[model samples]
Target: MPKPNEPILVALVLAAGSSRRFGSDKRLFAYNGTPLLQRSLVIPIQLGLATTVVLKPTDELFLPSLLGCYLHHPLLKVVYADDALLGMGHSLSAGIRSILQSSKSVEGALVFLADMPSLEVKTVRDIIRRFDSNKIVVPTYMATNGSLKAGHPVLFSRPWLKQLQKLSGDNGAKELLKKNPENIINVALDDKGIFLDIDHPAEVPGAKT
Candidate 1:
C-alpha cells in the first residue's frame, strides 16, 4: 500500500515487442537468475505501486517468467496487445488503457521497458516522488563527452493519459514529448542503467552460465 494519503501511481511495463533485433525471445533471457522481463519489474513491485505488464497476445513464452515473479500479486496485472506487431506505441496504449479501465483513482503511470533490468529501485522511487499531476518526469544521464542524454522510464501524469492512449506506430511517445516540451522535467541521474538495455545475449553482462 502507498503511504497514508499518497495518490496512487501505476507502473506500466511494456513487454510486447517482437525483439527482432535480439535474434530470439529477449524477454526470456535470464538476468541475475530471473528472466529480464520479470527482473525489470522488481522495483515497481517493491514500491507498492499498482503495476501492469503489457505483452503480445501471442507471447506465451513470457508467461512462465511472469508467473514465477508476480503470480497472484495483488498489485500486478497482465495485459496483452493484439496490435503489438504494429509497434511500441500500440503496446504502450494498451497498457495505459488497461490501467484506466481497471483503476479509477490513479494519479498517473510510470512507463518501463521490460529489457531494462538494470534500473535501481532508488531511481524508480526518486522519479515517482518527483512526479506531479501536470508535469512528466524523464530521467537523463551524462555522456562521455560531458553532454546529457535522456533515458527511461518516464512518468506520464494523468493529464496525458488520453493522449497516451492515442499513441501508435514505432515512434511511441516521441512526437508527444516533442509537442509538449514545456511540460517535461528531466531528472539527472548518476546511474548509467537508465541507458543500458539487454538487446542481445552478448550485450547482457554476466550472461554466461
Candidate 2:
C-alpha cells in the first residue's frame, strides 16, 4: 500500500502488438496452461497494484482470456489502442493516457510486457519499492553475451509522462531512456526471468505442470 498522500502508481501492461514475428497471437498463446498475457498479469495482481492492460481496438478473439483476468482482478483496467498497429510506442502512449484520464491521482507508471511471463513477483515488488518521483527505476541484468542489459518492468516518474505520451513507433521507451540516461536508477537483480520473453514458439520454456 502507498503511504498516505502518495500519488497512485499503476502497472501498464503493453499487449497490443499484432505479433507478426511470432506468426500468431502471442498474447493469447498458452504458456504453462495459462494464456501468456494472464501470466504477465500475475505479479501485478499479486502485488495489488492498479494495472491497465492495453490491447488493439479491433481485437476481440482474446477477450475471453483477458476478460477472465479482469473479472477476477478488481485492480485491472482494460483499454484499447486504435493505432496499435502503429507500433508498441503508440500502444504505450494510449495506455498511459487512459490511466491518467481515469485515475487522477496517478503519479507513476511501471511498464510491463505481456509476453514476459517469467518475471517474478519479487522483481515487480522491488521495482515499485524503489520508484521515485524524480528518477526512473529500471531492473537490469547481464545477458548471456556478457553485456549489461536493462529489463522491465520500468517505472517512469510522473515528470516523464509528457514525453512518454508523445512516444511513437516500435522504440517504446528506449528514446526516453536514451535522452535521460542520467536520471535512471538501475536495480541489478540475480533473476534471469527479467531477460526471458517468448517471441516465438521455439522460445517458450517447458511447462511446469
Candidate 3:
C-alpha cells in the first residue's frame, strides 16, 4: 500500500504492436503455458498496480478470444490505439492519455512492453521502491562484457506525461530520454531478465508451434 501522500503510479503495458518482426501476433504466443502478453502482465498486476493495456483498434474482433480471462480484472483497463500501426509511440501516447484522463492522482507510470515476459518480479519491485515524482527511473544492468545496458519498464514522472502524450512514430521514448538526460535516475540491477524480450519464436525456451 502507498503512503498517504505518496504519488500514485500506474503501469502502462504497450501491446498494440502488429508484431511484424515476429511474423504474427507474438502477444498471443504461448510462453510457459500462458499467453506471452499475459505473462508480461503478471508481475505488474501482482504488485497491485492499476494497469492499462493498450491494444490496436482492430483487436476488438479477437479481444474476446485473446484476453477474455483478463477482461474482468478489477485493476485492468483496456484501451485501443487507432493509429497503432504508426508505431509504439502512438500506443504509448494513447495509454498515457487514458491514464491522465481517468485519474488526476496518477503522478507517475511504469511503461511496460508486452513482449517482455522474462522480467523478474524483484526487479519491478525495486524500481517501484525508488520511484520519484520529479525524475525518470530507468533500470540498468551490467553486460557480461562489462558494458552498462538499460532495460525496460521505465518509470516516467508527471512532468513527462505531456511529452509522452505528444509522442508519435515507432521510436517510443528514446528521443525523450535523450533530450532530458539529467532527469533520469538509473537504478542498477543484477537481473539480466530486464533486457530480455521475445521478438521471435526461437527466442522462447520451448516455443509452441
Candidate 4:
C-alpha cells in the first residue's frame, strides 16, 4: 500500500502484437509448462499490482480459453485495441487511454511486453521501487559481450502518459524516450532475463510440446 499522498502506479501488459516474425500466436506458445503470456504475467499478478492487459480486438474469440482463470483475477483487466494491427503504438495508446479512464488513482504505469516471460520477479519489483513521478525508470543490464542493454517493463511517469496516449504507428515509445534522454533513469540490473524475449520458436528453451 502506498503511503499518504504517494503516487499510485499500475501495470500495462502489451500483448497485442501480431507476431508476424514469430509466424504464429506467440502469446499462446507453450513456454515451460504454461502459455507465454501467462508466464509473463505471473510476477505482476503475484505482486498484486492492478494490471491491465492490452490485446487485439480479435482476441475476444480465444482469450478466455488461453488465459483461463487469469481472466477472472481480481487484479486484472482486459482492453482490446481495435487498431492493434496498425502497430505496437496503437496497442500502447489504447492501453494508456484505458488507464487514464479507469477509476484507479494512477500516477505511473509500468509497460510490459507479454513475450518477455524470462523477466524476473525481483527485476519488476526493483523497477517499481525505483519509480519517480517525473522520470522514466528503465532497467539496464550488461550483456555477455560486455555491452549495456536496456530492457522492458519501462516505467513511465504520469507526465508522459499523455504523450504515450497520442502515439501512433509501430514504433511504440522509442521516439519519446529518445527525445527525452534526461528524463530517463537507468538502473543497472544483473539479470539477463531483462533482455530476453521469445521472438522465434527457437528461443524457447525446454518448451513444452
Best by lDDT: 3
TM-score for each model: 0.95, 0.92, 0.96, 0.95
Stretches of candidate 4 off by over 4 Å are 1-6
Select the stronger candidate by TM-score from 2 and 3.
3
Q: List ranges where model 1 is wrong by over 4 Å.
A: 60-62
- lDDT of candidate 3 vs native? 0.89
Lowest lDDT sum, 10 consecutive residues, model 4, at: 1-10
Give the best candidate by TM-score: 3
Per-model CA lDDT versus the true structure: 0.85, 0.83, 0.89, 0.88
Model 3 lDDT tens row, 1-209: 45687668899999998888899889889987888888878988888889999999888888765675787789999999999999999999999999999989888999999988789999998998888889999999998898889988899999999899999999999999989999999999998788788888899998784
RMSD of 3: 1.2
Tell me how far candidate 1 lies from the true structure as C-alpha RMSD in angstroms.
Answer: 1.4
**Which model is ahead, 2 or 4, in terms of lDDT?**
4
Error of 1 at 30 (Å): 0.8
- Tens-digit lDDT track of model 1 for 1-209: 77776767889998888889998778777787788887877888888888898988776554765557476789888898999999999999999898888878888899998898788888887888798889899998989998988878899999998899999998889899989989998898887888798777888878642
Candidate 2: RMSD to truth: 2.1
* Model 4 / residue 58 / CA error / Å: 0.9
